[model samples]
Target: MKASWRARLAGPGYVILNGIRVINIITFLDIIAASVVMLVKISLTSGFFFFEAVTHAVTAGVSIFLLISELPWLCSYFDRDWPLLGHNSGFITLGIAMFMLGAGVLGNLNRKDMGQDHLGMTFWQIVLSAGVLALVMSTINFVSSFVFADGEKGVTARQIRIYGAVAGQKGEIPRTGSHRTFRLSMKREDTLPIYSPQAGRKSPTDRNSTRFPLKIEKISSPPPNDAASSRYSRDESGIAPPDLAHHPALKGEYI
Candidate 1:
């Protein structure tokens, strides 16, 4: 009886352990991250510095890890849905190239054109406009997540998993993580399915059927705001300012 009970217990133990491994240490860090972000959201809303000052060390670390894991996914989904916005590498490359070209070449070229040196209208007006456009495009890239994943993609979220069949013939079973097998006696002409990591994902909106994103986490961000400032900012009356002491120049600007 004890041996049988131990056998039963082993299965459950394996499942739990698998979940822990998949989430990795991110589970613990994700909690801290989500909490810090929630704090930022609430901090913006209440206009009261809960921790006196933003714990840059903690929050920054959280943001960095979360961004490392999730931002690529978000950005990829965005660029996939909207090609004009471009992906991370595309955006980064363009920015870097444009900076070098304008700063190095345009700067020198403008030196003699109208009798100026190492400076040009390419400053913020034109280049910054491109920068702003790039920013807007990147935002467009990020925004695509809201339309599909949030409150919609029911089937895709539940049924969609990266899956494969046994890769080889019935005579040989896979030699990798957690191999489960079942055999059934049948007619002499029965064929068994082979499974392997799919050549690609099968998700409908995946553009080309991608199975996994760079990362997956429950989506959470303060919703879109056209006002440019968060809810925690002050009003025209300048009554309750959000970190006014920190943002002195825009004391009334954001308000």
Candidate 2:
């Protein structure tokens, strides 16, 4: 077979791509490291917050980028449809896994508010906050193997494994295919419930409830046609004579 100028003169194919791979791997790994440590420190002692959970998820993503970074060489072991980038990929995956595992362990150490004051703390509050951080960080570490692992060592990056199982030819094709159907049929099923324990539950004082035992009396109303002044008992101001402004003698009488 005649080798192309790029293949022969360019040294191994891996040399050409290794620069990008190294940078991506290191950048991703450092982010994962920082996230893991942050996740752990909080999960064990304090706990996760809004963005911290997102960062933990990002850590898991790094492993995937690491795997993709190594595709230059793992493909040569057998007759493969695509070449596998060899040892570099596996080494990167292993390194990521080891770090994640360590982070998970560090996160696990401070479970149950082991470091905080016993007073002024609620049981579920600690569990809810701390456990989530631990869980997210631990999940990132565990899933790192699946997301970024390359199975072999000492394989050059150029060995190429496009199908992933190229040496075995068992990997399935990724569908960049129709997402239109998915989009049309997509259903959003929120796992969280819309209702809470207090929802629709009423207290005794609430007017809507019949369970209130407070005494209530129905008072009789006065007839509309009758003058209030002539009805029943009256106040001092009522049933009184009209107040005359002044008294004057009649026209026929002396002043």
Candidate 3:
């Protein structure tokens, strides 16, 4: 049982599961951190107003949690149904909208024109600082999302299927040259199928027909008395037998 458990844990499924868990944990932490940052910004803008800070913190926490949780489904939906607005473009649009909304709200906040006596900072000054901070945070989050969108796991399922199809009977990874060509081919949107309902119904003959035919020539064994066979039986000095050395084809050669 222990060995089986260990083997299961070591399997690709376990690795993918662990990776997904790690990604979720990291995403949750990011949401919390963003909420905390927003709370800090709100406090700073409101001169450390406790009630306002608490309200903003709660609101931001819930909003961020929900947004991050639903983000994957939202992106997937857009990617599947809305080709014009792709996943990356949707994310970019959302990020831009969020930054603009936050900045606009902060900019329009009602506060004293003159600097506050206690905080020693004017309303607009705090708003400006918050706006800048918000922009930086949003930009960082957007870039991180775009960069790590595929997660820290290995090749995706589609990539694995493409590789398997490309490899065919070899059952090994493609050579460096072929790999480079495959990578280049992957850039084309229509080069590989992402998902196909008919994939399972594909016959081996059909698949083989699609692949370039391998040239497999018959490799016949050499004759028993041939110079090629006698070369291996030669002396340590690498000299062939008298009969082999005297052969017309091997007259001047060592064999």
Candidate 4:
């Protein structure tokens, strides 16, 4: 039985799915915590009939709904036809808006109440702080839903994973860290014989390709009648061209 459970848990995406679930649970817990604080403040002041207390009650209800949304085990009971009981996008969106509205109203009221108090030590402080934290967490969860969509099997979240067979067949696996493969490919390129241009000679691998070695033949002087030589020796020092007949660039053999 333990092995079977382990088998179910073992997968490339298991960790990611669990991480997302844990984050969502934590976010729901934050909302619950904040709502509890608000409810406590409401109880201490007046009944739910009061305007300020009604806002806290509404926020508390939304917080409970959000918490239930994260609990797959509890949600499975009424999730059949009930849209708001599970991790549906519409349900989450509605809960976020309702909770934020209630929290915002209570937060403003709490700020005003604090202005009339001598010592700032009150449940309002805790409620305000927790509400801020819950708001931040709720925003993160809502935004992240776009990236980690719900699974087809009605699971809360899932991640896309590429199987090894698919990668091997398609050759689309990203070579992220295979430095050795890159180095081996570079070595193969380096081992290829350098290209040469001597006519009638072939490269080590190809027959049509030519090969030649470069050499700069030093000429002592040029004939006076050679117009090209006049251009080469145009410098007033009268030095002959460094490469005259057997220049590598000309593809000529050494005489």
Candidate 5:
């Protein structure tokens, strides 16, 4: 049977792997192209190159870092037991890469020779456009990394609590069926009331109240009822009361 889109596409893990591969390919190509262009520009002109050098350096650094990030996926595919780098490192690296790209592009644009008068209009336009494209792509990758990483391999920003991953450290992913046990222990201080009566303090009693007049208020009796008084009163014979004689609850003969 043919696999459905769900099976083929799988989840963010596959997507991230494919994305990293694409990024590596693009970076590789960009490095080659930029190197050739830088060489040509250098050979053609003898002017001092400050911005160009910095731009290339930043691009090279970002590209290398991105390329190295593929190691985790590769290790997993090979069924190796390598300590997985926390997935949050992906977005953080992408953000840093984007910032570097933007800074490099802006610095490069500051050069006086960047205009059509010095470099051809076509070449200058291509440089500016490529920089913009790179920035947009980097931004998209960064955002997607953040969004897709939710609950993935249990390596989220909130779960990890770290901005980036540490190399050579063992990173464990929480299992789906794993249970977390939380214990609640009630100590004497916690189980007991916050306030307790002082030692040697006498409880409210008739003797104490008569002498010291305790602040406790006596419970008042219910109001007098003529019917209740007559119903419960017995005659001189001390037999049963006439009112309770026919009562359903007291109809049975007394012992």
Candidate 6:
């Protein structure tokens, strides 16, 4: 039996959807873990204060996490590439901010003698405080990510142009096709070469040296010349070919 058009595409679509769901679930679990860790780190004496702190911490943590998860898209919309938002830095920042905000709120409550009803906070007040804390923390993270990204080794001008022209206004970045070329170029530029004194001293004239000889194996035929030329090329320096030097893996030369 032949399948309908929708049926034909359903299998791959289901797999993609499931992959997205799994990623979201993992992010949620990470947020929950961070909240639990913050709670454990606190040393609250009163049960009421502990509960209040926990509530504030968990709410702020979740809100910050959600904001950070959307930050990359936000930056992309503005034609910016923020590496920190795409990594654990966002999660770490959220966790630390939640801990600090929780402690500060608890301290303020104690100072006001909320326990004794001298200065009690309403439910709306608590919610407002949490919201403000989330906003402050998220803003700090956004600014830090923008200001401190590694310009020398991170995204390049070409990539910025490509991202802006292709995906900036759309509020979404494409990961495949031409974008991959730019991504690969950025990755290459980030690579750093390790220097060794001994290796530096050794030269082509050190044939009598005790270094083990490199054995060339003919396991398979070489890649087509056209493909090799398009992807990479050899340079006179004998390091990465000039054409491929921008690649992260090739930029770093081992001794």
Clashes of 6: 3
Report how far residue 163 has shifted in candidate 3, in Å. 16
True-structure lDDT of candidate 2? 0.40
Deviation from native of the Cα of residue 169 in model 3, angstroms = 19
Give each model a TM-score.
0.18, 0.23, 0.25, 0.41, 0.43, 0.24
Expressed as tens digits, the lDDT of each residue in 78-142 for candidate 1 is 44664332321112332333233223222322323212222234332432333333334334323
Query: For this target, which candidate reaches the highest TM-score against the unseen true structure?
Result: 5
Supply the global lDDT for candidate 6: 0.43
In model 6, pairs of residues that clash are 187-248, 188-247, 188-248
> Per-residue CA lDDT of candidate 2, range 38-65, in tens?
4554543335365656656565564554
- Please give, for residues 110-181, the per-residue lDDT of candidate 6 as tens digits: 443343343334432443354344445545444433333223234222233223222123333333334677
Cα distance off (Å), candidate 6, residue 244? 74
Which stretches of model 6 miss by more than 4 angstroms? Answer: 1-73, 77-82, 87-90, 113-121, 124-255
Q: After superposition, how far is residue 133 of candidate 2 from its true place, in Å?
A: 26
Which of 4 and 6 is the better model by lDDT? 4
Question: Per-residue lDDT for 181 in model 1?
Answer: 33
Candidate 3 regions exceeding 4 Å error are 1-70, 74-76, 80-91, 110-133, 145-255
Show the colliding residue pairs in model 4. Answer: none
Scored by Cα lDDT, where does model 1 land? 0.33
Candidate 5: residue 53 Cα off by (Å): 3.1
Query: What is the lDDT for 127 in model 2?
Result: 30
lDDT of each: 0.33, 0.40, 0.44, 0.48, 0.48, 0.43
- Report RMSD for candidate 1: 38.2
* Model 2 TM: 0.23
* Tens-digit per-residue lDDT, 1-255, candidate 3: 643433333334334433443443344344345445445444345564787667556645544643443343465665566532342221344345447545543543444432244334543455445455555555654553443322222222222222222212333332334567787788765444343353544444455454433334423553366666666778668876676555788766644
